[model samples]
Target: MQCDICQRSPSSRLPFNCTLCARNTLYQPRIQLAQSLLQKEALEKEVDQNVAGTPKPTRIIPAPGGKPSEPNPSWIVQRAAAEQIVSEEKTQGIHDHVKTLREEIQNTKAEIAARKARLQKRRSEFASAKQELSKSQTGAVENMDKSMRRTEHRWDILHNKTAESRLFLCREAALLYGLHQRKRKKGGLGRDVYFVGGVPIADLRDLNSMDSFDYGLRQADSSIDASPAHVTTSNTNLAHLVHLVSHYLSLRLPAEITLPHRDYPLPTILSPGSSYTGREVPFPGSTPSHSSNNSPSASRHADQRSLPRPRPLHLDKKLSALAKDDQVAYASFVEGIAFLAWDIAWLCKTQGLNVGGNSWEDVCAMGKNLWQLLLAPPPRPSVSREPSSKTPPQKPSLSRPSTAAARTLQPENPKDVPPLGHFSHGTAYGYLATASGTEYMRDWGLQHPLRVIEKVKAMLLAERTGAEWEILEGNEWEEEEAGSEAKKETKKDVVRPGIEETVILVRPGGVESGINEGSGGTEREESDGKGRGASGWMKLKSR
Candidate 1:
């Protein structure tokens, strides 16, 4: 038969007790005790009957059966012995059960204690892990905060530099326009002069209306006062700056016809040597590239005569793509070009030169030639070649344009310059509207770094401040002339401001660098303790 509790087949060799039947066996102790009491009662009754009321007259019929062994005294003695043995056996069984129960109790207590100790150990481990996790999270947060701070610092530096550039360009354009206006008044050119687009010069919008520099300056100063350490611009501020510059340039150069100077400032910062150097060298394969036999004087003379070549003014396709992707940057680049053109025009007008013309080719040619003179190299013997079977040896000419030579040449009249064609608005603005053309122009604009704006501003600031003076005395004329020629040579070259000339650090007072703006200091002291003296340009602060 199957057991009821465990549902297993019962074993035949042992008792067929189920799990429930075994649990019910705990009542066996009471049953055993009852049975022992009953046996004792029965034995006592028999003994009483035999001892007190034994009326079973074993008459004299068995008188001969020995004296009946004294009615079996042996029976009473045996009964007493049996009773004692049963009592002792029952007591031993109870004692053994109690001992087994005590051992079980001890084993259970030990198990419970071990379980509690294990639980406490686990709890401590959990607590330590939790604490470590919290520490790690705190450290991660701190590291993130530090990273953000560094990124913010870098952004501030870039933003401030950009702001300064924008301000300098605006101020320069304004000053230059003012100068042009004054000269125009003096010459009777009339503000009503009609441009190729039929728009009167006077009709152009004034730059003063788009003065983001002043607004930004105020905000920057306020920010500096509020924090005195870190200052940043909102997107709104940056967009406003871009719009202001773009609008100003639009008004200044409304159309290509309204271009301040005929391709003035050209697309390149430097003019090419072969085209503008005014001298020619024999074909490359005809002669060796260098001659070791030339003396130091000859080499020096050659160096003085040779001007640095102009960088090609072509647009880089890759850079153009990058610029096109950034509309604001592209706009900034165009505006920068417009500012440079305006400045050049003003410079030419002040020198009593005509910059306006109708012929595109002529304008480009004139601008290039002008650049050659403005950035003339040190006086060198002009190279002239004589006819010979072999490549003619070149001879250097001594004649070079100087103040003396400049005084002799007459500037052309604008009226005499031929017009190429009627101005077309579509052609002028069309290129800018397209991606490819815009990118191309952007590439050209980037040829000149933004630092040029700083240089120009520094130059203008020095002139305005007037705290510095240049002395032309004694033999200083000859020396000055030579220096002036050298200066012109590097003008069109890719010249950049020295470290002393740039705003290296922003300070609470304003801006700080090694540049000294004061005029009274010794030459060495002015050049940051170097003997070179301060450069012609001085450093400027944003304010």
Candidate 2:
């Protein structure tokens, strides 16, 4: 029998078992090989069955009534399902994106509308504010214009009248000075004295300096030979020069006096609306009655309440910043002018004579000096107003013989014309040139300088008396309450008239005659009492 354990015949008989030695190696090899071959054959048979079975044609299922249909593969069904799921997800995502976009668009529209509303509101508010500002500015401009016109009118009246009277006073002073100088000199010069304008145009240096004494003497001597044209030309030139000086003086003098310092404000003349009454110049021998209830400072404040606030020229600020030397020079120059004006004013009241047409500048230029104008004899009677050659008339000349040429040069009937002392016109109007300078003087009523001075004096006196309420009405404090009873009580408070009763009267024309009357009385009393009295007017002149 063929052995199963070994492929070859068993070398050792063991009844289908290999020999013990060959059992492991040979027998085991044979058995494994046979089993492997059998398993390979079986696998091939199974594979063949599966391949051959799939060859079974795809089944065509008949539809209920018509055409046959092919069954779909499972994978294709799954793929379709997956594709559907993906498409659904994509659609959902697209929808969500579109919704978010719509929401963003709606939010943008709402934001745009809100911004536009805010911008419109702001623009309207700006326009309203701008309109209000324009209205306010226009109103302010109108008010300022009205105030300026009123102030200017007041200034014109006050300044022009004051200047006119003051000029007259100054002329009077020059005459006085001239008389005094003449008194000092024992005898009058050989030349006859005559007056032209306010100047004593004599050959003496004491009376005039512009022309040398020799030249003036020669001219007076040659009056007998001089032509009318020469005399007229000379007088015209003199008048013109005097006019120029006065014009410049008016502008400069006030500026110096009215400019504010760090410590002091402008005076009332320059600042009409200002309520600042300057340092109260007390009346002579008039001590302010001090009370236990009121201190000096308190009284001053009370007095200040009646006055306007002082306005100063802003130009002083520049001076304050200047060097010390410059400041001192400026101050001295201003003081010099003020002092000169004061001196000239003083001479007028003391002299008792008024020199018409003569101004401060005229006195300075035409006169030798203040002493000379006061002391020297009157100017030689000459051609003050020369006549034309056709109708020349003769006037006697002290210096030379009467000739036809001299007669023509001399004024016709010198005594027939009013004397300088007789003419009392204010300097501003006394000369044609000075009158030109005061174009602003039109419509201004005449006022006495002394009257204005007296008013200032009374105001000061009132202040010193601690009666501020008396000087300017409506300046005093009253206890006002809200109730009707308080009003009745306030009404019961009567105004007591005192020294200041006439103070207000002094400013207006109503009391001008009265002021003159009072002043005349005061002057007579002063003149009779102490030989030289320092009345309020005199005191102001002294200042």
Error of 1 at 29 (Å): 47
List runs of model 2 lying over 4 Å from the truth: 1-76, 155-158, 178-543
* Tens digits of lDDT, candidate 2, 413-506: 4443322222223333223235432442322222122332333334333432432121211222122112324433442232233322321122
What value does the lDDT take at residue 206 in candidate 2?
A: 20
Model 1 clashing residue pairs (backbone): 358-420, 381-396, 381-397, 382-396, 382-397
Q: After superposition, how far is residue 161 of candidate 2 from its true place, in Å?
A: 4.6
Question: How close is every model to the real structure, measured as TM-score?
Answer: 0.21, 0.27
Whole-model lDDT, model 2? 0.34
The TM-score measured for candidate 1 stands at: 0.21
Q: Please tell me which predicted candidate would have the highest TM-score against the true structure.
A: 2
- Model 2 TM-score (2 dp): 0.27
